[model samples]
Target: MDEPEPERKVNGMKSIFEEEIKKIQDEIDIFKSGSPNHIAIISEPYSRVEHIYNRILGDNSQKINNIQIFNPVKDTDFFSNFYSNQDIIMMQNCQYLFSRKCCGFAILEEFLDILFSSNKMYITGWNKFAWNYLKEISNIESMFQEIITVPELNSKTIMNLIMSDVSDKVTFIDDRVSEDKKFICFEECLIRMPLSNKEVNISEIKFNFNALKRKKNNKTMEDIQKEAFMDITTLAGGKYDVARKIWKKSLKDGEVRLSRIPQPSEVEISDIDELFILGNILAMDGIDFDELSSIVKNDSLLKQKLYNLVNKGLIEDSDRFYKIYPEAVNSVIDELEKNRMVW
Candidate 1:
């Protein structure tokens, strides 16, 4: 499924960099001690990797502070009121594409240019194009302290450059052979990391489901619908209404007791059409209003009932769409699948 783009704004590039610089400065202040820590932060807009970074920086005890720089054109609301620190420096990583504008790459290049001209930061590595640019503009070897990139050179080439006052720190960090470039699986990378350094207890930051349920129960609706509209009630209401209807039908048939809420063992699978709807929804990739309408097409009775349950919070609008809450779906499914109906 295609994902929707975040809201946009004009001149988003300028705003994005400005925000990054501001956030970097703010984070520095928050983490800065007499002795500063060296931190590296990286993120891509499409990946949820930034969430991990956020969790890391939010640890008040950690010495490192980092920020993910992005082009705000895609999502203008994303970086508002970000962390305030002055010790952090922002760098943009950019790449080129034939069809679309590479905003991130452009911004990174711009920042690098300004930093280099002001002698604020040293260039550690460069591809051929960047190396040529530096050479044409100035004596690159004399200008920078180090160069970390992949290239072949003899001892004579190095000696000659140094004799011409072109010596700088040059080293190769990659020792891989040309033919050894192959795709590495995620598991391989995980195995390489030290297990002792990994954080095993992540429950501290995770949301408590029980706490969320309590909060939901406490929220009082300010107004109620004038009539029992299919779409007007909460998901919980829809489930209650469906259960009530089933209960009444069973009573009329003299098959079950109305006073006691019938357990799963007491009810037959065939009697729970609402349960079937729930199952189908739980199976769907993303249950939205449109998907539900498509599934219950022309069946106003089912649609209205389901909508009411959603409105009443009996079933939740999980994932902010027409999809049934996963918890509700699982509960209903478990009941239908039970061997001992009442048990």
Candidate 2:
């Protein structure tokens, strides 16, 4: 018997998640075999590192024990006592251990000392931008025995992930014109001649006959879904959170049209204060007002800069914490790089 659609989608998403978890598990297994080195999992803001960490603990509950999870916020005290019976420690958001100010490394140094001296196994999650900065300024990279960078999801995986969780019936509408629906295209490429050692520009015709046939008739639900998600994935740069945000925006009254996928607005950042504020937010992943104020030093100036950023739709404030908007992560990163604020 054929599997139900929801069940099939669940299984597909599970397979993709398992594939990602397996890579981390393999590295963990090596550490479990009496390796002295601890593990570090790093990824960009809004990536799947935290989700994977939780899944690992949940899935291995029977086999893995004596584990404690710690999620630290700004000005967190790392000197707190650990459970004596706990054999493994998992620390999330280690970026909050330090600020971007003078004497910022004090807490980080203390934490590293505890980490290095402890006999228990350690697992840490870090913001990728923060990790890079820390690596450049300090010897933090050498401390981790194994480092795992979370992989980005492809268009197919993103589609499966989004669809699997959707219980409501969603209709995918293909609103593209005939020209936009073309399944064949011509492209020019440079090829080197083997004997002459010279390159020649050649035009090549590429065809997707199956897609063409579908276009002539009615497109299958699967084909329409793939095309919509492909556009979403490209716009999201394969980040799950960004893709999901796009999905939610595209959906209206249980219908998702191809033309409804939101495009990222242009971000303009010229002020030096705005650049610094954005850099701090990106590096810390998510930070509260006080912590950010500590980095910026001037409370009044910081408030105005953050307000401007929020108005620009480049970042959002939740409670007291500020984070880059899911869709604007790439744009913010590009702006920071242009200003040489981030490496």
Q: Which segments of candidate 1 are over 4 A away from where they belong?
A: 1-271, 311-314, 318-320, 326-329, 338-343
lDDT by residue (1-343, candidate 2, tens digit) is 2222322123334444565567657765665533456778888887655467656665544333322323333343434544445566667777877777988888788888877887767778888889988988899978887888777889998887888889999998987645545587888999999989899999999886767776578878778899999999878877888888889999999989998886655667889999988998998887888888777889999999999999998889998789999989988887888888887
User: The CA-based lDDT of model 1 is what?
Assistant: 0.33
Model 1 per-residue lDDT tens digits across residues 175-284: 22333233221221222235565634222233455555544654222111111112211211223223224323333332232222222322233435455555444333
* RMSD per model, one decimal: 29.4, 8.6
Model 1 earns a TM-score of 0.20
